[model samples]
Target: MTNIDIEIPHPIAAALTILVALCAIVTVDHFTDFQASAGGRAPEEIVRDAEGEGLRLRQQQAVLQKREEILRYQLEMLREERRLRGPGISAAIEADIDRSEQMLLDLIRDQQEAEGKIMLTLKQIWDAQGRAISISRKAGKGVISLTWPVEPTLGISAGFNDVHYEELFGMPHKAIDIPVDQGSEVRAAADGVVEDVSDNGYGFNSITIRHNGFATLNGHVESFLVEEGDTVRQGQPIALSGGRPGTRGAGHITTGPHDHFELIVDGERVDPMLYLPPVPN
Candidate 1:
């Protein structure tokens, strides 16, 4: 019979071979880990872990945001309390105070109005009494009559050509102008009681006398003959010759020496020719 040879590996070498296989497998895993973030795990599992971490971080941020909101609310409440405690109150509260103050002011105004009315009543009574006393005088009872107020030489010439005569009455020209010289002689046309002897400035004097409602005016005269309270006769020499001759009155010596004579009936001036006898030119 022929004998056959069989080879068997040693135990130590078999263990070394197994160790080498383990080392080779570890080297492959390290190489893969160096190149990629995950080592052979499912894509879903890796994504799920990432999402969980993000969720945790978001929750922490949410907690911080809640803390900030609470602090803001607390600060706002403290300010509100301080404002309400001092003069920093709301506008609505101030408006109510203003309304109460205005009500008191209105009461004061009402009391002042009542006092003013009472004083006005008393003043009216005093004025009426003084006016009544003045009405009882005898001086105002006299009548007024105009005089042929120029020198005898000017008698005809004084009342001559008085055409625009009616322009002497009513409204603003309530008084007619009897232009005479600053020093021309003036005579009474009729009997009259003198009321006022007034200086109408410009060296031209005026005589206002009364004959009932007939008011006679001798204006622009230089001097006066009859006093304020004198009674003049029909042909009496009442005023001296003239005025600032050739001025506004223009009662000069020659033709410019004219008398502006007016006769006022019922507080209104009328043409003097209506009363004077026709001149014997």
Candidate 2:
């Protein structure tokens, strides 16, 4: 019987080690199913997706911000009531104030979160005119239809009366006044570009949208949602009604909180009832 030890040279041993490492790497790579840096998506596609997300987030944030403003305004009203009512109604007023305060706080938090999301979205990636063009295409489908600027349940407070101020302006009172609760949403009558959003010299916040062969004016609004030059679809909220003849953001006078809706055709004031459907009882 004999025992033998096989000795290998250092160079051959090193070569064997290198071969094993190469084989291990190839096996791992083959089994792993590796992906591209962008997770098999094209870089351009990723950018486009990010931009879309950003746009959506911005819109959502805007909505949340509007809600916050409404809550704050409500809170102010509640406080004013509490002050005027005095302790006789303190118990009820206090409860309402407490609830309003809580709601306002919650809305603020939500708005902050939405704002943060928008900021993060912007940081991650990203079109103003392009969106407007897309909206235009979508709005152009079918014949243009108009939606009631205010809820139809509320009937016209003042019927169209052109002769009321015919001397000052031949077509004065051409617009019907549809009274609604203050701070109520005022939507677009039809798809169109926001031709103007003016507060100065008008005595009230007003939004005018030019549609096909006609235009609509929404006045006595508390606040505007859409800015000048923005494209809005029918039924989209353009402003909040400033109910009553109160001195709101603009000093526009009204019998009460109402939506002053005016229709203009070929730059001439016309009765809105001519085109608007009758309100359901």
Candidate 3:
């Protein structure tokens, strides 16, 4: 039996061993880098990063809370200002009052109109009983209701159908005449749109307002505060009353300074007193 000795190269063996060790070291470093990204960092580093992120989030929350507080303070201030101004003084409150008052006036007008119808029915019943119903022409003319157009200080110089005056008509005057001081304000009887503003060269400055189904005429006006096609609310000033005996716009048929007020229903002239608020005592 012959014994054979195998010779291995030292440099090749050493290089092979070094390569294996280098591969093991590279694999360990790669795993460590992966662990750091996956939240497996060193304990001290993890705590430091967590504290920083928490502080940042808390700061953001504080900022948001501060903004909320500022908004709340501003809202409170606005409320306080409104409270200090007193009731019915704010714009919204004033608007509400105006709306409510207008609605109430309108309701009253409707109720009065209904009452007029009821009175007419009562009159018919009386007539059926062989009793003559003496309906006051001035008080109940079966007409729609309206707000007063003039101030209380004024008085009716001539009534709707006074046969005493020739200028007022031979039998029945179509309108009423209320004496007013110079430059007295004349308001609308109800909500309406101005249909016409005309002047008769003889002396009648008239402003006609068209309502729901009726209309009102403000005649013998000195000057008009509203124009044709203008919308007016009930009791809204439409003209300055001026129809004196010698005024520029005084009606030729009018005896003195007065507002020749007329109410027309469905195109037919009616007595104004029946619709207007009662004459001030």
Candidate 4:
């Protein structure tokens, strides 16, 4: 090896260096492209997949949010019930409380299934209530007379077809809500036979009394004092007022202790105030 010195032009040397750098870059880019293609998805497909995943996550979040809301409401009911459970409770009442708690837990586990069952139960109860009213209309042939179901001392909390109720529950309130103390006496609005007593498991326990050409429903009752088919006189005690959250008869939604009263005339729900005496000042 004989050593010979050859000096190249600076401009040509610079051009060669740039060319080599360009080739390296091209090789690296090709390798990266091949690696990406090995996954059997194009760049656009990868981007689309990411977008789809994000959408799915968002939908799942929405479902979870709704579930959380339902759980919160149920939990509030549970807490109220627990608070109402005092010491020295009777065994029968304790067992009922346990069942109620279990029902709430089951609802939390399977909301959709529980909701379906509740809807079905309500439908059946509603049909029975309607039948009771129909029977009353057919059985009697006298003029309608009415009395107050509860003392007018508390006045009315919510009225017939209450707009606020419709806004809150998305349905018109066909009855009236009379604010009364918990465990207050609920009296019969008129002389009638007790046709039905039922509970809808959501805090609505009611008694329907059939009178001449009309019917009366007293909801949010703690307990029935009279049994079905028993004749009751006007101003007679029929039930204890409820509507206290977490109590025996107070359903899921209630503002406070009160009575939900309905008066049906001609098979239609009308304003109870129209038929009842004016509230005492």
Q: Please, what is the TM-score per model?
A: 0.37, 0.46, 0.46, 0.58
Q: Count the backbone clashes (under 3 Å) in each candidate.
A: 26, 3, 2, 3
lDDT of 4 at 111: 72
Q: For candidate 3, give the lDDT of residue 64.
A: 34
Q: Using TM-score, give the best candidate's number.
A: 4
- lDDT tens readout by residue for model 3, 1-281: 99998666697888899999999999889878867786787757677768856754564444333332322332343344345557757576445335433433443456554334323322332222111111111122333659878865657766766665422222235678777655789999888778677654324567777776677777778788998879999989998887543344553234445677777765456787776767668
- Local lDDT at 30 for model 1: 80
| 1 against 4, candidate with superior TM-score | 4
Query: At residue 254, what lDDT does model 1 achieve?
Result: 17
Tens digits of per-residue lDDT, candidate 2, 51-140, equal 867766665455344444444454565565567667787565467457645744664578665344334322321122222223333333
Candidate 1 per-residue lDDT over residues 1-281, each given as its tens digit: 89886665697898899999999999988857844767667667678758956754564344333332322332343344345547866675445334433433443346554234323322332232222222223224444444456644434433333433212210122222344333566787777677666543333345666654356666555567788778887878887644322233222111223454555554334566666655446
For candidate 2, the per-residue lDDT at 35 reads 27
Ten contiguous residues with the weakest lDDT in model 3: 129-138
Evaluated with lDDT, which candidate comes out highest? Answer: 4
Score each candidate by Cα lDDT: 0.47, 0.60, 0.59, 0.71
The whole-model C-alpha lDDT of candidate 4 against the native structure comes to: 0.71
In order, what is each prediction's RMSD in angstroms? Answer: 50.9, 17.8, 34.3, 19.9
User: Candidate 2: minimum summed lDDT over ten consecutive residues — where?
Assistant: 121-130
Which scores higher on lDDT, 1 or 3? 3
